[model samples]
Target: HAAFRAGLVVCPLSPLYKQNELSYALKKANVKALLLPGCESKQSSINDFHGVFQKSELDEIKKNLKHLILIDGNNSIPNFQGFEVHFFDKLLENDGNLSEEAKNSVTSDDPAALFFTSGTTGKPKGALISHYHMSNNMKFALAKGLSLNGPVSVPLPLFHAFAGIGASVYPIKHYRPIVLNNFWFNIKSTVESIVKYNCVEFWGVPTMVFNLCEYIEATNTKIDSLQKILMGGSPVYESLIKKVKRLIPSIKELSIAYGSTEFGSFVTQTGINDSEEIALKTVGQVADHVSLKIVDPITKKIVKIGEQGEIWVKGYCRMLGYYEDEEKTREVIDQSGWYNMGDLGVLDENGYLKIIGRTKEMIIRGGINLFPKEIEDVINTHPNVAEAYVCGVPSEKLGEEVCAW
Candidate 1:
C-alpha cells in the first residue's frame, strides 16, 4: 500500500514460484529491488523463504540489484555481498517525508502495477494496469450491487488480482479493515481468524470454501459473523454452495466473480439479491459500461442469442496491454478495442453470460466438434464420481479421442 501511494509500480511474486519461474519474472520485469520475508529467529534463515535469490543464475544480476529489503528479519541481516541490503523496519524507521509536489505529480493514467498471468499455456505474460483502471473497476463492482462492508477476510495470495486488487483496493477505498490470510491457507487458522476478527465479508476460491466447509462440518463450529462470501478462480459447484449453506446459515449471500488478471479484476459477478437459480446458472449479468458479445470463434461474426460462441468484452477496466508483447497484445485486443476473451459462452436475451468452455480447449473427433465441458458435466453426474475432467488425445482413426479423469 505504501509503494502504491508512493507512485511505485508494485509487482508481487508468488511464493509458489520456483527458481526458474522467479528468475524469468524478475528479468522480464527488470526488477530493481526485491522485498521478501526474512528469518525472524536464529534457528531459521531466509534461504528457504527466498531460494530464488540464492540461485547461481542471479549472481550477475545481484550486482545490479539496488536494494535487498528484508522483512521480518532480526538485527542481523544477511549481506548479499554486492547489493545494498537493509532491514525492513530500519527503512521504515528512517522513512523520509514526501513533498506535496511528489504526491500531486502522480496521475490516474500512470502505471500502478504489473500482474503476470498464471502461465497455464506458456510463460507468464505481464499485464500492465493503470491506477484509473483498477479504481474504476472497484467502483463498478460496488455499483453493480455487491454489498461489501465492514471487516473482510481475504485468503488469496497477493499475486492474484482477486486478492491484490479486489480484496485490497475495495477495502482501502471504503476505509474498511482487510485481514490477510496466512502464507499457507489453513482451514483451522482461517476459521479462527473469522471468529476472532468478526469478519462480515469474505473472499475465497472454490478450494478454500470447500476446505472451510469440511472443517466446519468436522468440528461443528458455527460462525455468525459471516454475511457475504465471494468465490471464484474455478468452477463453483452447486454442491459446494449447498454444503456451505448447510454448515453455516449465517451467510446471507453467496456470489461468484468471473474475471482474469488481464481485466484488472472482476468483469462480471452475481448480484447480492439475485435468486439462487440465476446465480447458479450463469456468471451473472455484465457489469455497467462493459459491453459483451458472443461471436463465432472461427468466423469472427456475431452469433445468435443463446448460441454458444466466443466471448468478447470491452470496458474501462481492461488492461492497457500485455507488457512488452505487442504481437500477443494485438492477437487479443482488436482495432475497435474489443478483447477476444477466447472463452466459449452463450449470452441469454437478458444479457446474462453462461460460460460453456474455452475455444482452445475444444476437441475435434472424427470431424465433429466436442466440448470437454459437455462430457465432464455428464461424467460428474455419477453418484460415485466426485469430479471429472475431459481432454483430447491424438488418434489415427478418430483424429482425436476423449480422455477423462
Candidate 2:
C-alpha cells in the first residue's frame, strides 16, 4: 500500500529465496531500495547474508541498491556495508504527503510492480506489471463474482501472483478485510484463524487446501464461517475436490482458477453457482475483456474447438513484457499481442478450459504423445494414492518412456 501510494514499483521477494536467487532478482530488476525483516528468528535474512556473496558481486549490487530498510524496531540494525540503512518506523515518522508533481508523474501505464516467475522450467524472469493491469484484473475478478461476504483468509505466501494479487490486492481494492497468516501454512493455525476471525472466504493452492481438508476430517473440525474457497497455483484433482466437499459440507463455493504471474491475476475462474462437475473438471470460462485461444504448438494455428493445444491469452491482464529481456519476451508474445501460455489445454465448445500439461513437459514415445497431467490425473483417482507425478525417461527402444511416481 505504501509503495502504491508513493508510486513506486514494489517487488515482493520470497523469504525462502537464498542469497544467489536474491542477488539475481535484485540486480535484474535494478532495485533501489529493499524492505525486509530485521530479526525475528535465528536464521534471519540479514544474518544469513553474511558470507553468501563474493566481494565483487556484493560491490555490483551495492552500486544500485541505495537503501536497506529494516522492518523490526526493537532489534539493532545490521550493518549493510556501502548501503544506507534505515529503520522502517523512522521513515514513517515523517509527514505522509506526496507532492503534486510526484502524483502526476506516475501514469497508469507505468510499471507498478515487478513479479518474478516461479522459474519451474528455467531461471526466473521479472514480469513488469503495470498499474492498469493490476487494477483492471481485480475489477474483472469482482465482476466474475469473487465472494466479498466477510474477511478473506489467505494462508498462501504473498510473493506469488495467486496470493499476492488475487488474494491480497483484490480484497484491498474492494475495501474488504483480510486475515493474512504471517508464517508458513499450518493446518491448526489456518483453521483457528478462520474460525476466530469469522472469515467467509479462504484462498490457497491445491496442496494447502487438501491438507486443510484432511486435517479437518481427521479431527472433526467445523468451520461454519468458511463459505467459499478459491484454490489454484497447480492442478486441482477430482479426488481433492470431492474430499473438500465431503469434509466441509458448509462450504457453498469451491472455485478453481488458472493464471500466471504474467497475467497479473486469474484469467479463468469457476463461479460460485457453477455445477459440481464444472467446478471439479474445468477451470471455468475465460474472464471478461480477455481473449483465449488454443493453438497447435507446431503449426502455430488455432485448433478446432474441443481440440488440445497450447493456451494463448491477450488482454489488459497481460504483463508489460519481462523486465529488460526483449529476446525472451518476443519468444512468448507475438506481433498480434497474443502471449503463449506454454501450457497445453483443450477448450470445449462451452469455452471451459481443461489443462493437459506443459508443452515442454510433453513426452513422445515411438510417435505417440503422452501428457504427464493426463497420466497423473488417472493415477490420482486411486483410493490409496495421495499424490502422483509423471515424467519422461530415456528409453533404448522408444524415443522416451513414461515414468510415474
Candidate 3:
C-alpha cells in the first residue's frame, strides 16, 4: 500500500517468510505488485491461484510494477499460477528473437542484479552486480566444480547472492530443473531427497550437514548415492567430516567451502576426498580466477606465506563495491581495487589457509588472546559430540570469556 502511494513497486525475490510478511506489510504501507517466489504450503497458506502470483488483492495493491514475476530459486513454485511464468529465456534473452544490436551488446558484464551492504552500523550501500560475476561463479560452482548434472537443493533465499547465482541462474543456464518440491529438509527428508533424485550434491551451511549427520544416524537410512556436499556459509567442524565418511561411504568427496554474498567460492578443498583435516586445518587453495594476499593490518605490508595477517582478494569474481556509498566502498576496496576481506588467516607451508580467527571473532580473555574455534574444535573432537558455535561473552574479571555453545 505504501509503495503504491509512493509510486514504487517491490519485486521481492524471497521465500514464503518474506512473501506473506511483505504482503501484510505492503498492505499496511499501501504498496503493491509483489512478485513472490514460492508455492503455498502449510507454513505459507494458499491463495486461490495455485501458488503462483494470483491476480487479486495482492496484485491489485501495487500500481507501478511493470511486471509480476515469480522466481522460485528452489524451483518449487507450482505450475498452476494464472500468470505465465517468465524464466531466463523469456525475460533475460528474449525467447527465440534477438536483434543484432542486442546480440552485440549482450556481454557478461551487463547488469545482473542489485544488492546492498549490510550497513548495520552505517548508511546502506547498494551495489549493482554484473552477469559476468554472477554467471561465472554459478557456472564453475555447479557444472564444473560440484559436478552437478541434475537438480540441486536451494534452501537459501535468492535475495542473497549465493542462492541467486549458484542455485537459480547456474542450473537454469544449462536447462536443468531445480528440485523445487519438498521445500524444507530434515535428516529424513534430506536423505530422501538424495535417494529420490539420486542427487549428487547438496549446498548448505555446516550446521545443516551436522544436523543431517544426526538424522541419518538416528534413522539408519542408506544414503550412498550422494556425491559431494558443499558446506560454505559458516566454518565446518572436523567431526562432521568424520561423520560423513563413516555414514555415507559412497560420497566421492567432501568440500569445506568458504565464501560469501560478496565474492563467490574462492577456495576449494580438493584432494580432500576423505581427509577431513584439509577442511578443519585449512581453507583450501585459491580458485584459478582469484589472487590472494595476507597483509599486516597495522603496517599495511603483504606478509609472507605461513604468517597470519589480514586477507585481501583481487579477481574478476570479486564484487565492484557497495552500490551508492563511495566512502564505505573506499574503506573495503584498496586503491588498487583489491578487497580487504576483514578476515585474518595464514597460507600454511602447503599453501592451504588456516583461518586463525576473524579479526573480530578473537577476544582478549585475561590478556591470553582466545579464539573460540580452537576450544570448539577440541570439543567437536569428542567422539559423541556433533558440532559447536563459539563466541566471547562478558566477564567482570577477565574482561571477556570464550563461550562454547
Candidate 4:
C-alpha cells in the first residue's frame, strides 16, 4: 500500500531464489531499497539471507541499496555501510507529508509493479504493469465472482500473481483479511489455517489440491468454512476434481481459471455456480472486457471452433511490456495490441477454452502429432498415479519419442 501510494514500482522477489537468482533480479531491476524477512529459520538462514547482496555480481547492489527494512524486526537496526537499515515498524510510525505537487505527479500511466515470469527456459523477464491495469484487473476479478466477502486462505507464494493479488490486493480492495500459508506450502499448516481462521475461500494449484485432498482424507480434518476452491497455474485433471469433491462435499464450487504473469493473473474463470462438467472439463468463459482468439501458430490465422491453436489475448489486463526488453516484448506482443500466449488451446462452441499444451511442448512422432497434455491426462487417470508429466525425447526414426513420469 505504501509503495503504491508513493508510486514506487514493486518487484517482489521469490524467497526460494539462491544467490545467483536473487542477484540477477536485484541488479536487473536496479532495486534501491529491499525489504527482508526478519524471522530467520531453517528455510531462510541468517547467512543465506545476507549472502544475496554480499555475493551479487553488481557492485551497485551493495553500494546503492540504501535501505534494508526488516519486516518483523524488534526495533533493532542492522549495520551496513552507507545504509539506513531499520525495522518496518519504525517507518510505519513516521508521518507521510507529501507535497501537493508530488502527490499529483504520479498518473495512471506510471508503472506500479514489475513481476518476473518464472524463466525455466532462460532468464526471467520482468513484466511492467501500470496502476490502471492492476485496478481494472481487480475490478474484473470481482465481477467474475471471486469471493471477497470473507477470510480467504492462499498457500501460493506472494511473488506469483495468484497469491499476490488474490491474497493481498483483492482483500485490501474489499476491506477483508487474507490468511497466508508458510514461505513454502505445508499441507498440514495450510489445512489447519483454513479450519482455524474459518477461511471461506481457498486457492491453489492442482498438486497442492491433491495434497490437501490426501491430507484431509487421511486425517479427516473438517474445514466447514471452505465454500470454494480456485485452481489454476496448470491444467487440472477431471479425476483430481472428482476426488476433491468426494473428499470435501461441503465445497460448493471448484473454479478452474486460466491466466499467466503476462496477462495480470486471471483472464478466464469458471462461474461459481457452474456445473461439474463445465467446471472440470474447461477453463470457463473469458472474463468481461477481455478478448481471446485461437489462431494457427504458423499462419497466424484464426482456427475453426474446437480446433487447437495458439491462444492470443487482447485486454486491459495485458502487461505494458517486458521491462527493459523491447526486443523480447515485440516477439510476443504484436503491433495490433494482441499478445500471443504460446499455449495451444481450443475454444468450444460455448466459448469455453480447453488448453491442449504449449506450442513448443508439442511433439511430432513418426509424422503423428502428439500433445503432452493428452498423454499426461491419460496417465493422471490411473488410480495409483498422483500426477503425471509427459515430455518428448529424440528418436532416430520417429523424430520424437514420448516419455512420461
lDDT of 2 by residue, 322-377 (tens): 99999999999999999988899999988899889999999999989999998998
Tens digits of per-residue lDDT, candidate 4, 1-405, equal 678778888988887777888888887887888887654524454335554655565466765566777777344554456667777777888887777876888898898888999897689999898888887776786466645468888899878977766665777677777888776789999999988888888889988999999999999887778888888998887778888888888788888888988888888889976778887678899999999999988899999999989999998888999999999999999999999888989999989988888888999999998999989888877989977889999999899999999
- Residue 212 lDDT (model 2): 90
The worst-scoring run of ten residues by lDDT in candidate 1 lies at 41-50
Residue 8 of model 2: what lDDT?
Answer: 94
For model 3, the stretches where C-alpha displacement exceeds 4 angstroms are: 1-12, 16-33, 37-105, 115-127, 139-151, 172-178, 184-189, 271-274, 366-368, 382-386, 394-399
Q: Which residue pairs show backbone clashes in model 2?
A: none
Instruction: Summarize candidate 3's per-residue lDDT along 133-204 as a digit string, tens digits.
Output: 766675554332545466565555455565555654666566655554344445566667767887766667
Q: Point out where model 2 deviates above 4 Å.
A: 39-56
Report the CA-based lDDT of candidate 3 relative to the real structure: 0.61
lDDT of each: 0.81, 0.82, 0.61, 0.82
* TM-scores of the candidates in the order shown: 0.95, 0.95, 0.74, 0.93
What are the per-residue Cα lDDT tens digits for candidate 1 across 171-196? Answer: 76787888886666778888999999
**Steric collisions counted per model:** 0, 0, 13, 0
